[model samples]
Target chain A: MELTRRDAAAALAALGAGGAVGYAAHEWGSGGDDSPDAPDDGLATDEEVRDALVAVAEVVYPSAVSGIAAFVESFLAGRLEREDHGRGVRETVGELDELASEWYDGPVAELDPEDRDRLLREVGADVADENPEGTTAERVRYYVVNELLLALYASPRGGELVGIENPQGHPGGTDTYQRGTP
Target chain B: MSGPATNRARNRAVDRTPVDGADVCVIGAGPAGGLVAARLADAGYDVVVLDAGPRFDPGDRQERMERAIRPAYDRPDVWGVGGERDAHAATGEWFYPLNHARVKGVGGSTLHWQGMVMRLHEADFNSRSERGVGVDWPIDYADLRPYYAEAERELGVAGADDNPFGPPREEPYPMPAFPPSYSDSLFAAACEELGISMHSVGNARNSETYDGRSECVGYGTCQPVCPSGAKYDATVHVERAEQAGATVIDRAPVQYLEHSADAVRAAEYATPDGETHRQEAEAFVVACGGVETPRLLLLSESEEYPGGLANASGLVGKFFMDHLFAGTGGVLDEPTRQNHVGFITSESHQFYDEADAEVGPFKLEFFNYAGPSPVELALTGDDWGDALLERLNAEYGDHVAVGALVEQLPREDSYVALDPERTDHLDSPVPDVHWNVGDRALETIERANQVQEQILDELGAEVTWQAGPDSTGPAYHHMGTTRMGNDPEESVVDPQCRTHDLDNCWIAGSSVFPTGGAMNPTLTIAALALRVAEDIERSL
Candidate 1:
């Protein structure tokens, strides 16, 4: 069996742990005004983008990491400006906000880490198989969380944690090639 | 031996009409066309090669690495519809979503090809006679053995070629393969622990610096782009063809062929600016992949042959094939320490020959994709914040992945024809693929699953991901659309890849493959191209 997030969480839940352990694996995909998502009307304001990054970053990344919010916001905003997928990403985060409001009666940024984790897990798993037809959280995993995590680890700061030390394109010293493969 | 020219020069591409005279016109500046154009031009025959997409170079090693390591453009501007002008794969029912994977450029899909180059097993050639499945190729493995040897030298292949699993070769590979990483070594031991035979296969990538290219630098990204130029892309050969007096025109989408009296007279290409350009040549070879080849043939419908050009057998776009692929991944308790390194190391044909008469043979390729990237892991699973980061920090590279390519027998129904409604920007009809795997392929996939399980289980892996039957991702080898056979009545092209309808029009690349074995088709495609070029030269 593949150790999915739900699997690990369920394992933790079985251990009677607290603080995001017992997430409600509710039957999801409800709520919202029932109109189709807008075709990416550019990114939201800087504050909105920053809030979205901080909310997800607080849930997905390690705590006490300085400048985490700044790193994520710049990465997210920069991608939105460039790639076409960035527009979809911006829309997905807005969807996450919608789902967060429905589930917790508040925004993702305001919700405690536990509630945020719960909503993300429930929404994320619901849309795991196939998507564009799910609650905001479910699709947010695809659009926002997916890109967020990608931006985090594929960067130099993220690479340092995993022993990559100097990410290839981080504008470093003379040698750039990683002599790892044949 | 018979591929790249030693001349280093720029490939001056024509932007629009009034094309330069050429002895031959080859459509698609890909592996086959690039090599053929180079070979002809080397022999002093003026050649013109046309590609639909713009020519995008990966630049020098460091720059290429920079692009690969960056985001959005992380995969080079070679994939998808709008980003880099690659085709939107016309998918059919039950076929995998293939549009975002294949690239379009002067180097063609070779720019994005994973450099796994292995010859078809001898048994693969006689499947019709021996296995009682699929049509027998008009030519055998022995017929193309010399050309395969030549392609290896030209492409700078490195491997231990004296394997019992492989077909007979005239000589050893040009260089020994790169050493396997520690994780790969563990995977090999696990395979051995389960009594499975494992060996390294020939890779087109350089093990040590040879020719003008550098060695592999382990960027872990070979599919989208190869940084060090160690893995051979067709642009260098296309440039060589240019140096030898051949011309490659960018954005010249070949819409149709202009033929008369059972011979192709001139080729018509739609320029980017909505203008048509006529290029006449002594001979015409369409190497624009399997789908594009048939699409072009069908789009070039004439009054004499209303159905399609050179489609006299009505098999021009039939029997389209892709190898049955099943991927498996698992995580280990201990870090492999050799994660993120990206050389394709060991391959096992231990389970290649199936005893079950219901299924075709399959080859399981082992890869050291031991790192599922901390970000991917964090994004997935039920971990959040410190939990996610802590988990990621501990187990980044402690992962392993292995996959198998089951031999898919040619089925008549799985085909590629011109979509009746759809057309490209050039107003040429796009390919409509009707492809799917059957019960035989499923059985092969199940067997592959068992092999994957046997290895992972022995290693005491905690978790695994094997989308066995759900694996529909294409292996990217487009073949058998313009299949080769002895009878003109049954096949689109003859054994020498000459269309029965047109004497001067020949087909090149994997498009002419009668059967696609469980190995990557680039080298085989290269071999066929070299052989066809030689034949074309002799004829000229």
Candidate 2:
């Protein structure tokens, strides 16, 4: 119930961000090339970013959820292609890793599930207001948490999980509309 | 000092080579211009249509639809409506978003319009006699009755004879009506409880493939873009005109009309290649919509008629009018299945012709796309997994909304004139729209909101938003700039839609509307364009 309250507050923050940005629907991770991980300019390598996100997803996602690593990896490929968004995402991941090293004596990917969740809470991401150009916790909520949620809800598979058989942009034909939900 | 004669001399000094001389020259390639061109071409006349915008590829609709669906993409950018070329000045009480409301391409604003079509009631024609407010149209509903039927058939309207308040029609709609959306059915129960009547809305979109286009597959982004070709746009008529031997020159914006005291000799226009050319014709038709039609007339000042081309009465850009939208939305306790349909399937015209009502008429619309989209619900949530699912289910389908188009009376204060300060890409003065919601319109909006609130209350919904008098905005139904009248001293155009001052120039489209009713103007526009085409044929 407490998580639900926090989630509602976070949802409003994410909505604000979503309103400011335009999103397009396409095959996840289909367009971008999969080059080998090459970290540059103090940003995290793609592999390190994927590892850390998967660890975060393990704690953030529900216990029934499966394929957390694969989903995060695929979604990241597409997100990393957009220049400004990709740089912000990389910086957020790098900040998370720094916080992880300082708190848990290692990288975020190497932390236990409970420890990773605790690390997120410790950084005040769960309570801080989400802002793209604010504090580290706000940036984490803006670039990291909202990005994951957007990818999940925008996808057809994730949409079905939330009773959205056919999302707004998808063409589900006239029959789906003519018949009411049973 | 520079005068009309000096401007004419300066224009003549430029390379004004004549091109595409025809029997009739249509200035715009919008619904009115396209319809006129098609009819004149079919009647075996050499017609040439000059459009200010590029001809959009039908195949690129899917990409445009993507732009509309994506939250990050701007709506204006999706239709290519920006840059110096489309700039205009809005020095009104409220900022009039002209560029967002109009598209300048081959199909014009129809390219992005929600395809609702309705006929003006008999009372709408005789507003002066019936309502004691706005002036009566020179021509009545009886005169346009046959043309309305023809326009419906030409535009391929899908509807049912269910609206009791509608004017009498001789023929059924071209196609059967679209079934009511799930949300409309929900509203029906609440409306029935309150003793209000609901009827199917007539749409230009196909119900079951009427004119070579496919039936509605419900892509659901019908306003800004319809990926499927089921929805009708003015491009349909433009293509029909082209097939009937009408030559259409795209990206050709007419700068000014070259004329003497009696008739227009030619239209001087600029192409994409930065060259000016003259289109000489036997008769000239300015089929641009309300705003641009008057702007064009004002821009075409000459030594013969210095005030403006057809401004001997000084009424070219006067009596401007638009319909204002009053909307009320809320969330019901149960699922309404909102956003299932892109367009409205049901509406109420019960209050449209209210007997002896002081306020102007208003038509209620039941919105099918009222709630947040799935993507919107998803992004706004803070929960990642199971908790997020609960929130999405609770919020997605319960939202409902009611909207009304309130009639606006033509006023002296609200008119379109050329802005002295702002110039468009071609260095021509841009249209300055001076508009304000009058006392009658404000009263109508309040009445409409009250009606909507009653419906929402009957539904036992939690009221979230209501657009009151101050919040009500234009429905983008521009009308009554070059209003039609019999007297030459009072109005710009005659009963035949001919400019009172110019012998050979005719005006078509909503600019000639004496009074704007609460219905969509496109069907009436098409009918009047067909009539203009017939008149031009008779004259030649």
Candidate 3:
């Protein structure tokens, strides 16, 4: 099912995007490398970040899930507007691209779906304990994998996939709660 | 309307500028204060009510509900609780999370409460006479029965006359009870097998539109915020009081009460714009819940009454009480449809009046929001795609739980006192709650859990979790601080809720409860507040 930008924005707001963004900024500020090999501004362009997130969403979300690219793109628009979250996303994408360049001789956004999935596994993001400030793997899981999942599930369309017609924040009336599933 | 103002300011110069003296000045705009102010105002008595917190706009409830639903928004921050303003000290075996459990705004804690309204059983008032433990209240069930009906109607309670264990009522509830949730239906057979009878819980949330409020449209975030004005909050009565021509001031925390040998002269309060104002009245009512009511009295220490204002017995803050919770939950083989209902529908009070048992009384609750919500299950899972969908379907439903509120006896050791070292933003000693769970309470919790396990076993469910006796915590129903009694030396207030030491000054709320039965205290708080209003009116 198709999800709109409004659904994605509501999802982001429910997940406390501002708090997550602040945590991301704090994590990146304290632990991020200041190497010359990094981007000149220590941030990637919005297009680059969007491309990388959509690529990662392809691997993280269910294969049955449709319109992932549009959903992730819509989700990113709201997320990237926040300066702190934008910089955190940009830096995270830059790090992923650096690793892709070293391992696959290409950027993550250009890799095949299977290769992109393998890249996340190889970076230990699939196995790492999800933390905002622990390690590269943990940061990837916190900012990339979890962020996408939270956005998806918090949305009404995504919630429908699991039979949650009305998530907690949404105003599902009394009749909705009174009976069993039809 | 100005009265004599004395030199009662502790740290700063007292502002003699009178902030509208009335016939009755009610402190704390909670359920108790709201009811008193409304009744007095309607009776043609001039009333002024002062609240320590902001008057939240009802329009902001949607955003507040969102804040409650979101994981990152701190729960206390949802009601604007925390900081130095709400700071309190806890010296108990179990950490009394006061800030998390209370709201100080115009609506008070009812703004975030679960809206369960149950009257104390007949035996609750005669615990010493019937059960051989705890002190008997000066007034019994018969005394408050009419007021309970009035309170139920006033708060627009939705309930049925189904509880055989409940005290006798002369009238039906204002509205019919909400039908049991789907999960409650699932537990019916198991409960039947165990011979544990379940009945509808009386709730302030509207089943149908009553008293101009909307019917509960199940926003599901009832604890911290109800976006719809379906659930009854004290703001309802506060507004009613205002409509009846009572002056209600918010963000005006009373610092101290200046009292003479026989009566309270005035209440010195601090306003938002950095000014102190004294309010004098023919009668004064302190309805600031259990903790703050005693703290305020203790803060009102005078040279005439060295212990505190109307604290001749030195029992102003003693005998503090709170009901402890016992919870048990498991996964049933069939779908239970958990997390659909935010408030409870089914409860068993059969064990609430066990006179022969050594353990204290307890009321069993069937939890509707027992299991994890869809968002919680989705966010925590490690799987993705069809695997994630499989996990969600497998784990989302098929969960059920039962909780019980066990009675805690009022002990002299468990008290609310002024924390000498820590002061609040008002530059007065914050309330120090010294609470300790006794052996009887622990025994009661164990017994309650056993009964819960029996029902779960009858369902052939795998027990996922159980709150053992040691794991028990309070249900946040603060009571019995300024206990009411016939003797002035033992209790702070008399049977009429008037201070034994002062003729005109009165105390309202659960602070005057001699013994808190294992029920939600708000209903009784309302009943007592209504009664206190009558007492104040008669005296005036």
Report, for candidate 1, the interface RMSD: 10.9
Give a tens-digit lDDT track for model 1, residues B1-540.
011231122322334564566789999999999999999999999899888876764533333442343332435333323532333345555654445445566888887788889888777778877777777888999999999999998889999964666677778899997666566677777877787877887888887887888876555566666656778899879999999988888878887799985999888987755688899999898988977789889888899888899988898888888887787778887766444545457888866655235877888877655545453455466555666677777776567778888877788878887767765665556677788666787888888888888888887776468858766466777889999888889898888888888989889989888878788899999999998998898888
Candidate 3, which CAPRI tier?
A: acceptable
DockQ: the better of candidates 1 and 2: 2
Fraction of true interface contacts that also occur in model 2: 0.49
Clashes of 1: 6
Per-residue lDDT tens digits for candidate 3, residues A1-182, read: 66666666666554434333422232222212343455476465667777888898888777767777777876776666455555667777778888998999988899998899899888877766555556877777766776687678666667677666556655556665557764
Put down candidate 2 lDDT per residue, A3-86, tens digits, no spaces.
222232222222222222322322333221233444355477677777888788776655555767766665565556555566
Model 3 regions more than 4 Å off: A1-61, A68-156, B1-18, B380-391
For model 3, how does the per-residue alpha-carbon lDDT over B415-503 read when each residue is reduced to its tens digit?
99999899889788999999976788899999999999999998888999998787888888889889999999998999999999999
The candidate that wins on DockQ is 3
Better of 2 and 3 by lDDT: 3
Q: Write the residue-wise lDDT of candidate 2 on B1-540 in tens digits.
A: 123475456545533344455999999999999999999998898988888887776755755664565443567867889889888888889678887888888999999999999999999999999999888999999999999999999898999999999999998999999888888888889999999999999999999987899898766778887767788889888999989998888778899999999899999899765899889999999988999999999999988778789999888888888999999999987777766558889999999998234699999999988878776555443465567667777778788999999998988888999999999999999999898768888898989999999999999989999988978788888899999999999899998899999889999899999889899999999999889989999999
Pairs that clash in candidate 3: A62-B385
Model 1 DockQ vs. reference: 0.11
The candidate scoring highest on lDDT is 3
Among the candidates, what TM-score does chain A have in each? 0.61, 0.72, 0.78
**lDDT, model 1:** 0.69
